[model samples]
Target: MATTSLVPSSADDPLAYRPIALVDLLDRVLGTGVVVTGDITISIADVDLVYLSLRALISSVGALTPPEPPGGAG
Candidate 1:
């Protein structure tokens, strides 16, 4: 009898399991820009007591800046 693996090995796939450092992850996230949204609710005896909603964009200054006008500066 023979057994087979369900997941591809890193050697078999170039895009497979590569570890990224925290700094690298942050750089990529900021470079591409990301949106985070969440909601929180607190209830007592099925009665809602508090609720919160949040939305945020995380990115680098360069990524958020708009491009200059078509022609160069006036």
Candidate 2:
């Protein structure tokens, strides 16, 4: 008795397809990927906290003066 082959040897077969690389897959996913559009709503609390933190950080950083010129005041 002889066993029969389940899959035929052919390049067109589904199993013969080449595997995709992770980098290529990610590139396609991250670049020119799907675009989803919808309405988004956020509570005032979240927005207020983010804005306040950014304002404080910006103001503090802006207050810092540059070091004195190498030639003593430009």
Candidate 3:
């Protein structure tokens, strides 16, 4: 994210992320990349909608995890 700094892990360890905030990761990915716009052979107006919906769905459901706990000794 442009406004957020990367959180680092232990010194002896490799750069590990603690499951980066979904919004933050997306922001950084989008912001850092070069955005190029040109005349598309295919209709961009239609393609653009697919891109937008996919991004929205990813942000909404990507980071969530299941709440189940391990079952073993009782």
Candidate 4:
């Protein structure tokens, strides 16, 4: 069996394809933040038996920090 990749191979497009490490990818995602949402449903005989909804926000702690008050430091 053969699998297909969505990303273009480096051999096919060296300039356009640059593989990123998993750690680097995660770092970028966390720095910028991301929202993920999904829904799942299971049905039997056209009747819905189970349903699931999920939502999540991922970001680094520094990215979530609130700005300082409008005043000089104490």
Candidate 5:
């Protein structure tokens, strides 16, 4: 049997869509958040049967710290 990696490739990698850094995630979830609102409606036989709605708010980690100066405190 041929060996294969469990990690998804670039084409279908799920992690690729998710945040990889905690700080980055926090920053977006608290500072610059994203608001998502959606609704799905399904009907069969000319009658509505299924309906779905979703809403969420994501924020980033408030303010980010400034980078320190380089050159060992010149």
Candidate 6:
């Protein structure tokens, strides 16, 4: 069976994209991580989604670290 996209194709479609923060985006999803070369032809689109999600997770985790105070700064 052939399935057609529901998206109404238009020039504005490209402009409707979004850039979400790495941590806020990754919180809901579950996974480790994976990297690949650009030349690879497999599931390139989904890869971007995961990559962005991972970045957000890392960023959020980084912000959670406690900073040391002066003197001992522990």
Q: Which ten residues in a row have the lowest lDDT in candidate 6?
A: 49-58
* Per-residue alpha-carbon lDDT of candidate 5 for residues 19-65, written as tens digits (9 for 90 to 100): 37997776656775688899998999989899999998765334344
For candidate 1, the TM-score is 0.65
Rank ordering of all candidates by TM-score, starting from the highest:
1, 4, 5, 3, 2, 6
Best by lDDT: 1
* TM-score of each prediction: 0.65, 0.24, 0.28, 0.60, 0.38, 0.20
Q: Which residue pairs in candidate 4 collide?
A: none
TM-score for candidate 3:
0.28
Question: Residue 43 of candidate 4: its Cα lDDT?
Answer: 100
Worst 10 residues of 3 by lDDT: 51-60
Tens digits of per-residue lDDT for model 4, 1-74: 99988888778886876779999999998988999999999999999999999999999988888767788556
Q: Which ranges in model 5 have alpha carbons more than 4 Å from their true place?
A: 1-30, 61-74
lDDT of 3 by residue, 1-74 (tens): 36644566556457665577988877765544433344434346565433221122232222344445678434
State the lDDT of candidate 1 residue by residue for 1-74, as single tens digits.
Answer: 99988787888898887789999999899998999999999999999999999999999999988888988788
TM-score of 6: 0.20
Query: What's the lDDT for residue 48 in model 6?
Result: 41
lDDT (tens digit, per residue) of candidate 2 on 1-74: 99967655555576664669998866665554444444445458566332221211222222355557688964
Cα lDDT for residue 15, candidate 3: 62
Q: Candidate 3 at residue 2, lDDT?
A: 60
Give the least accurate 10-residue stretch of model 5, judged by summed lDDT.
Answer: 59-68
Q: Could you tell me which residue pairs clash in candidate 6?
A: 22-56, 23-56, 69-73
Residue-level lDDT for 38 in candidate 1: 100
Computed on alpha carbons, the lDDT of every model, listed in order, comes to 0.92, 0.51, 0.49, 0.89, 0.71, 0.49
Where model 3 places Cα greater than 4 Å from the true spot, the runs are 1-9, 34-74
Clashes of each: 0, 0, 0, 0, 11, 3
